[model samples]
Target: MARYDAIVVGAGFGGMGAAIQLDRLGLSDYVILEREADLGGTWHVNRYPGLAVDIASVTYSYSFEPNPYWSRLFAPGEELRRYAQHVAERYGLRRRMRFGTAVEQARWDADRRHWVVTTGSGELTARFLITATGFLSQPYTPPFPGIDGFTGRIVHTTAWPDDLDLTGQRVGVIGTGATAVQLVPELADVAAELTVFQRTPIWVVPKVDTPIPAAVQRLFAALPVTQRAARLANTAVLEAIMVAGVLEFTRAKVLNRGAGLLAKAHLRTSVRDPETRRALTPGYDFGCKRPTFSNRYFRVFNSAHVRLETGSIAEVTAGGIALADGSEVALDTLVLATGFDLWQANFPAITVRGRDGVDLGAWWRASRFQAYEGITVPRFPNFLSLNSPYSYSGLSYFTTVEAQMKHMGRLLGELARRGAATFEVTERANAEFLDRVTERLGTSVFYGGDCGSARSYYFDPHGEAALLRPTSTLNAHREAVRFPLDDYVYGGVPA
Candidate 1:
C-alpha cells in the first residue's frame, strides 16, 4: 500500500485546483485519481453534438489562467477539453494524475489519523483526502418500464459514443434540459424524423455568441487585462441574474421578472406557432431551475421534421416509446438526455465513511445536506469536499473553484502553523453555517417561487435548496479568505 500527504479523487478543474493548493502549501506528496482514461472530467466524458459552454468563454475558465485563444464567445466542448489539458500541463499536474483509477470508498482511520481509500487495485492511505468528483459525475437514466427491452440504439448524452451517426435515422430524445437544448437542434438537422419528449419546459434566453477575431485574440494575449475586464463584465451580468434575481428574489423581483420577459420575447420571436411557443414556455419563475442561453433551441421547433411530445412517458418498447395518451413513436435511436442524478447519486459520488463509522450519504439523506463553508464537514477530519452543498456560488464553476482554493489556503495554512495532523470542523460551527444558509434561502426563488412544477435539481427531496450558496460571488470570496479559524479543531502530532 502506498501513502501520501493527500489524495484527490478527481482530475477535473476542481481536483486540479485542490492539487495546486496542496502544492502551494508545500504538501506535494499527493495523487489525483480519475475514473476515466483522461484528465478533463466532464469535458473529456461528454462529446455530444453542439456541446459548448453555456457561460461565456471569457468567464468560464479559471481567473488566474485565462485562455485568450478561445475561437468563440461560447467555446465548444473540444476547446474546453484542450483547455483542461493546457492547465494540467502548465501546472505540472500531469505527473501526479492516475487515470483509469476509480475510488470505491474511503474510510477515516481514527487511530492512525489518516484516510484509507479503497480502489479496485488496492488501498492507499493519506493524511488528507479531497473529493472533487464533480456534481454531474453520475448520469441518470430514468427507469422507464421496458426500457431494457428496447432493441433500438439507446444513448445517454453523457456516454455518447464516437462515430455513432444519426443522419437520416428516426431519433427520439427524452429531455429538454441544457444538454438537450444544445443537442436537439443538431439532431434535428440530421435525423429523418425527430421527436422530443419534454417533461418540464426550460427557460432559454438568446445567446450572444460570436467568433473571436484573431486580432482580438492577439489583443487579449498582449494585454491580459483586457480579458480580465471582459470576464469581470460578464461575471457582473451573471451575478445580477443569479445572486440578485434569484437569491434576492424578494427584493429584486423586477430583475427576475425582466429576465423572464426577455426569454418569453425571445421564444415568441423564434417559434412561429403560438401553441408551440406556449408549449415550450416554462411555467415556473425564471430562476427556479437552471436556465440556458441558446439562439437555435427555440428556432428548431419551426422545422417540419421535428415534433414535440409533452405527454407523459409510459414506457420504452422494443420498437420505440409509449406515451400516456396511447400514442407511440417508433425510432431507430433513443437518446436519454435526462441529466445527472444530483440529489441521489452525485451528492457524495462515492461511499465515504468518516469518524465513528458515519456514512456521509446516509447522514445527508437522514438529515439536511450541508458542509461548513462548503468544504469541511463535522466528524470528517482532514477531508474537504469541493462539490458539497452550498459550494456552487456563481454561474461560472471557476468562481467556486477559486473561492474554495482560497478557503483551502487559509484552513491549510492554519493547520501547518499549528503543526496539526488532522483538522475537522466543529459540529456547532457546521450547524451554524447550515442554519445561516437555510435562513437566507427563504428569499430565493427555489423556496419562494413556484418551483414545485419546475422539478429543479437545486431542491432535494427534503425541499431544501442547498445547491448554491445564497450569497454574492464577492461575498463568498471574502468569507472564504476571512472565515474564523476557530471554527475548525486541529489536533494530533506536529506535521
Candidate 2:
C-alpha cells in the first residue's frame, strides 16, 4: 500500500543508473526491487567458473566513474560485484534498495494516475515505473525430453550451486556460448571426463588479457585522465568492429571478413585435429551474433580428456544424454549452459499492463518489438523500459546505461517544466522511430549477412534483429540528448 515517486524493478547497473537520474531530477522517493538476496544483478547472480567481463575492464565501466585498480584487463566477476557495491555506496543508493523482492507485474491505473506494482512481498504504487531488468536475466534450459527423469545432478549456469564440485566427476556441458566457452576450460581441468554439446559454433578471437601492474594502477588513480584515454582507445576499437564492421556491413565488408579470418586463424592454430577444428569453426559471418574474446576456449579442445559432440540432442536419460544418431554419453553431472531466453522471458521481464489494458508482451509478439528512443512507448505513460529494442549500443553496457540516463534526464526535465503528472510517447512518434531504426538496419549484418545458420539470440522469434541500435554510439548519445520534446504528450496539469 506504500506509494512513492518511482519504482525501479531491478538493481543492476541499469536500474542503478535510473535511480541516480531520478535523484538528480529531485524525484528521490524511489525504491529498487531486486529478486536476489543482494545487488549487482548479473554480477550478483552468476558465479560460475571463469566468469569475467568479455569486454576490456577499462571500457566496460562507467565513463563517469572509472575503476583504476582492475587486476586484469578483463576483470573477474568478483571485481564487477565489488564495483557495483562501490557505485551503490558512493551514490547512497543502498538505502533505497529492497532485496529478495521480485516484481510479478505492473499495471497502469488511469484513475489514480499512478502505477500499481505487484511483488512477492506486497503491492506498491508509484507515479512512475522503470523496468531495468536486464536482457539476459532469464536463463533458458531447452526442454529436452526425459530431462525430468535424469537421475544425475542437473544444473544451469545461471543457478550454479556454491557447494557443488565437478572435480573427478564425469560432466557434460550442453552449450558452447560465451558462458560455456569460459566454463568448459575450467570443467576440463577438473572433470574426469568432459563432453561438450555444441549446436552452433561460436566465433572467438584471441583475448589479450594481461595483469595490470600495481604501478599502472597507481598512475591511473593519480592521473584519472590516463584511464580515460585508455577507455577511449578501447572504445574506438569496439566501435570499429560493431559500427563499421557490423552495422555498416555493406560498405565495410572487408573489415568483417578480416575479423572472421582472424578468428579462423586463431582456431586453426589452437586446435590440432582438422575435424575438431572444423567442428568448432562457425559458418556464419562475423558479427552476425555477439562474439567473445578468449585465449583458452579454443585451446581446451586440445586436451585428451575433452570431447566435442555436434550431434543433435535427442533427450536426457537417467544417467546422461542421448543423441539423435543413436549415440549416448553417460555422465555424473549435466550442465545446461544454454543462454538467456530473450524474446520470450525477457523484453518485458514481468507482465506489464499499460493504458487500456494493453499487455506489453502480447503486443510485442503480435506486432514488432520496439520502443521510442528505447525508453518510452505509446500507451505506457510514465514508464521506461531500460532493456528495450534498439537500446543496446556499442560493446560496453555502460554506454547503453549512460545514454538512457541522458534520455531520462531530458524527458523528466520537460515533465517538471510543464508540471505534468504523466508523460507518454505518441503513437505516431513511436512508429516513426521504429521505422527509422528498421530502415537503417537494412545495411547491417543481421539483414545482409548469412545469419540463418548462426542461430543467434539477437534475432527474436519474429526474425527481427532489433536488439542493438543500428547507429553509432556517438549518434545514439547525440540523439538521446537532442530528441524532439514534442514526441511525448504531457498531461495531468493545467495548461
> lDDT of model 1 at residue 467?
91
Task: Give residue 400's error in model 1 in angstroms.
Answer: 0.3
lDDT of 1 by residue, 105-188 (tens): 999999999999999999999999999999899999999999999999999998899999999999999999999999999999
lDDT tens digits by residue: candidate 2, 430-468: 999999999999999999999989999889889999899
Candidate 1 deviant stretches above 4 angstroms:
none
Tell how far residue 88 is off in model 2, in angstroms: 0.8
On lDDT, the leading prediction is: 1
What would you estimate as the lDDT of candidate 2? 0.94
The per-residue C-alpha lDDT of model 1 at residue 426 equals 98
Question: In model 2, where do residues sit more than 4 Å from their true spots?
Answer: none
CA lDDT of every candidate: 0.94, 0.94
TM-score (all chains, Cα) for each model: 0.99, 0.99
